[model samples]
Target: MNFIAKQMDILHHKADWFTHIVKLSPRFLLALLIIPVLGGLIAVILPAFGWAPALNQYTIGLEGFRALWQTPGLSTMMLLSVATGLVSTLLAFVMTLLILAAFFNTAWLDYIQRILSPILVIPHAAAAIAIGFIIAPSGMLSRLISPWLSGWELSPAGIFPHDPWGISIILGLTLKELPFLLLMALGILAQPEFGKKLREQHKVALNLGYYPMTAFFKVILPNLYPLLRLPILAVLAYASASVEMPLILGPNTPPTLAVAIMHWFNDVDLTLRIKASAGALLQLILTGCILVLWLAGETAIKYSFRDKLTNGKRAYNSAFWQKTTYILTILVISFILLALIGLIMWSVAGFWRFPSVIPEQFVLSHFQSASVQMVNPLFNTLTIGIISTIFSILLTLLCLESEQLNSKPISNFTSLIIYLPLLVPSIAFLFGLVWLQQLANNSSAYISVVFSHVLFVLPYVFLSLAASYRRLDRRFSHVAASLGAKPFKVFLQIKLPQLFAPILIATALGLAISFGQYLPTLLVGGGRIATITTEAVTLANGASRRTSAVYAIIQMALPLIGFILAWLLPKLFYKSAHR
Candidate 1:
């Protein structure tokens, strides 16, 4: 008995030491998050400056940039990238704000929240395809009211999708992005300070004769925008450099700058890698320029609205804004719901021709075929999502436990480091990470891909888990300790059990983030591992609407299943935990 006690004590001490290291040392987290991002940027830059020996470009020169600059329609591509990024971001932000201003705190808000999760879980490529399915020439909308509405036959003559002005791309991005921005905004409003102060401000403004819409805009948005700035910028960066959306929805003739950069990288000849690196550098510069312009626009809006805000004038357009906001929200939500319906109808559809609302025949052949063919991608999708989510939960648990044990908030520096992956354009650094991995000869597809997913997933998981983890009263742990429970046992038996609900939510979010990833999986997996996203995007470009719909449904369904489990598990197993 004495010997067993001694051994147990030794193990406890070792565990304590390990926990202490994780808590006290910032270096590990920095290495995982910040160093890689910075290092990847440097790697790309060095090659961009013509210093890569792997490609035999040993001379320090601007030839890479020169070659990239000489690409056809370079100017048009840049303009498309900038326009789509800004327009989509602006549209999403405005729509989100309008919805909040019009319907927040009402039953409408509850309905939106209830449906928001599923909307957000729809992968970008799936969303793009859904939107394209309705708006394209041969799509459901045209088929439903075609000759009666426009007197056209044979599916028209133009690309509603892949339009030259990038309007369709912008619309596609806006539809997908609005839900995300709204979700984030909801999270922000849930903050104690934001909630309390916003109510107070709204009341104060209302008492001063301002209407509800104006009150929210004038009183709440100013205080709220700063908190949301990072998320907005992240979205902008993503929009500017997005490959999947552009490939599916953006103009194909010139393509967005990000797609153009990818073409250079994916060229058959390896020498084009030098120019690709230069194009990647150009992408970073382009993102930077867009961000700068966004900031300037922010300043301009603030200045322009200063008089209207300060004068306390009840704007006459408040009612008009409110009416339009509700209309827009209904349209946006209805469009998404209808799009999902379109996907479902198409999945089992058979031989549906132009000007027909319903298919001439319905069959299960699509699912029967997809079931066999999609097994690999579906399995890969599930495996990668679970793996990345597990890693995210573990890393976040470590960080949160460390914060609890140390009784200190994570430093602002660490927060910025975690957000680095979100804000920095993936095109700028992902290729370099791929290059580094190649140089190191690490070729495990699953490991490389999941690592990339984890990088993106960690921030979201941490954000979701941190509040619950911190809000957990320390009294329970103190009592457990007083009862002679070792730190390890307490953390295992007490803390984790107490956090079952939040942990589930975080896991679900991480899973969705990983499941939705397109570029990371493609780049990190070396194109050998096909997830549903890759398959769906690939099928979208071809004349396989039925087959693509099958993939899209699976892609959208996987994350939703995870989320349902996340929401249901806590209720079923830990009923009392909700209170």
Candidate 2:
């Protein structure tokens, strides 16, 4: 009996020690994320001042800035970056609001979500390629109308996909980001109390001689915009600093600053790294300025419209706008679906030409060729994605568990840290990460690449999984503990089983994020680690449609598979509350 008592005492002590460690897990995660990002930013800033010891530049100077400014057409690149970023973000925001206001609980919302939930999982690179394939001068739409509706089909000269106006770039970014904005909006708007409050407010407006659309616009939107601001800012930052889409679609006379930064970074002369670093900082400054302007706009709008929000005259008969919004939503979804169809057709197409709606013959040569070439890239992509996602999910679970255990909500500082990766241009800080890796001589291809993937994957996993984890009824855990279940067993048997659906979905999100990483993979992996995304982006520079289609499809397939399983595995076991 004494021996058993001593053993019990030892076990209790061990459990206490473990509990204490778990309590600190959240702080550890914050440090793990904050340190690298802050360190990378500082590292890059040093290089921008010509202070890179790797290149034997011991003295700090502004020559890098000077070179960056002196580069030809720098103004055009800068303008393109700022314009596309802000405009697309604005478009996405307005579209999301209009769609939600016009059709929140209707069948339209259900249908749209059902279709878009999967397509949005396609990586930006693949989506951009699909959009490019559909809108190019000799693309599917052009083919459909050529030689019959229009004359002489030898690929007409047009300013799409490579236009000076950056319209193609905007379209691609908007198409891809619109769905994400919608998803984020759905999350906020789906809160029961928030939805009920909005419905009540909207109903009051509706009774006061306002259409539903107008009612939502004047009443619900002001209350809703704050929830969306961060995501909007993220979209703006991404659009402005986007490298892959602009590279594939923007003009060459003066590419977007991101592409130029990439060009300078990849230039043979190692000294150009200084100029690239400066350009990256400039890009960072540009994104920061955009954010400042966005906040300034918010304040201006709030003060200017605070009274009008309550007293604005109701616009009746908004049927036209509502109809337009609904039609526009369907059209956008149709275009995306058509683009996917275009990719599939092109991938298997044989002897396809202008004015041909369908290919005359089909062949598997491209797939066969892509299979052989992409074997290594696909392997690397899966490994990196799987490893990074596993780590992110594990870390996020622990962090959230710690949060719940401590009964503490995530602080503003923690929230900011979580969002830092998305806000800063990867160009600005990833180069800094590259420099750090070089300095520390820790440039192993596989490890660096996986670490890079985790940096990006963790945020998405946390945001998606946090809601589900927090929303689970506390009574289940309470009852389990009352029955003598320990915390670990409660987590394993109760929480994990209950959250399997969301856990799997979050894993899929992390997987998709990891799969789509481009710059992080490139800079950290040091060109030695090539994933399907890196290869796809490189191929998009000039590769043929069929070949590019093949690569794009493969990249899209991984995420599609994950998303499908995320959707299916839940229903396979039992009725899940996740979907």
Candidate 3:
């Protein structure tokens, strides 16, 4: 009993010490990271209950939710959102697995890895725009192919830009997500602990006469799935709550919930903001439901196949299926590359129209052209992106350190708050944020826009740093402390040196996320600040394929720059440090 009491007392002392150490560090960076997120959360939740002080509504009620429930075609719109999200995610997941299986040990693996760096850099918004530009009815593809193949004159009806099924939207999102998931899987596979053993097990199963895909499914995938859960969840959340893709490819009548929410938020009717807030809350719930369903399905699949795989049979003949998958992958990759090329062409084409196989003339005048309006949006985007990325990096470091030193890591509840932006439709919270901005009479659109970008970028920064931070050796810190170094100094001198690569990668990821932000930038900036994403969307809405293409190309370029910087900067630093 005395020993138990002593242990408890020591544990209590340790706990208090951990708390004191954390408190001593400046937490303002973390505070800055979370404030806008909380503001947005409060805005959404409060408006859902009809407690908008701006409108002199003191009493809370369910009128907003009721309105959302009563909205016509709401169920259909939600269903469309679900289908698009699930189909894209499922396809991306399957394709990623197939690619990983096929290329894990081959000579082609290095090339595959190298290809992902550039593709992963291209922002989804830009990718979506490129797809829209090429595949839309009257898009470059139809315009180019119709005259030659069909000998048919291209008309609005003949071109199927916004098909009712939303297939293009699904394809666009799937294409964008494929490279990201592949990159994430590469990162996971690079870890020595998991993939190496899994590969050996797979070979054994294959030798034992199990179907190769089944062996992969029964043996390899289960382990890969856990390492991949974070990226998969991110992909699902993104597809479910995505604004830009749906804007570009979803149908017109009742667009995806994301598009509807944006429309509601931007509506002149102040009442619509409440409805939009409620809808955004609903979107969050829907994403949660999908996540639950995915988890359940994953478990069910694992269990259903477990018994079948117990016998350890393997099929040696996988060549035919392997060849087919290889061809399919090539075709898909080719289509994506062609779409990217089409976007480049459209951007520079002078007055290119339908029925022409190529541009009549190319011009650099568009690239050279600059207007005050155009220039400011670009500057605003960079400014906000840089600010958000820097703050996200600093906050990520703090959260990672806190998790390291404390016995109890940060709770899922706190982590959920960081994920709030990704899990909910951006338009939903921005509706409430705009209301809050109006109430405060603080309409410096640039500040609000940057603040909103911080909210969206935080989760990604935190996530990218999380595994790297946890995997770090604590002995460095212990040694530094023994050498009389302060906690801050140890973090800066020892821990930071080791963590520099991951920190840079996380910052780059954050910068990419910010660069792609469309809804927050447009709404919080009050149409006053524009980024490449906003510019592309605006141009798309104008139906000027040429201008939209130019913006999309610019959009792709910005994130590409970030991706290259992320990949190269680390190698440079690590090489120098070793020397």
Candidate with maximal TM-score? 2
Off by over 4 Å in 2: 1-17, 575-579
lDDT digits (tens) for residues 527-576 of candidate 3 = 77867778778777675676777777887777777767877998988788
Off by over 4 Å in 3: 1-42, 58-72, 143-148, 153-156, 207-212, 316-320, 351-353, 370-373, 403-420, 435-444, 470-480, 570-579
| lDDT of candidates 1 onward, in order | 0.84, 0.86, 0.76
Candidate 1: list runs displaced more than 4 Å. 1-15, 24-26, 575-579
Candidate 1 per-residue lDDT over residues 312-333, each given as its tens digit: 6776588888888878878887
Which candidate leads in lDDT?
Answer: 2
Q: What is the lDDT of residue 241 in candidate 1?
A: 89
Candidate 3 versus the native: TM-score?
0.87
Quality of model 1 by C-alpha lDDT: 0.84
Q: Which of the two candidates, 2 or 3, achieves a greater TM-score against the reference?
A: 2
Model 1 C-alpha RMSD to native: 4.0
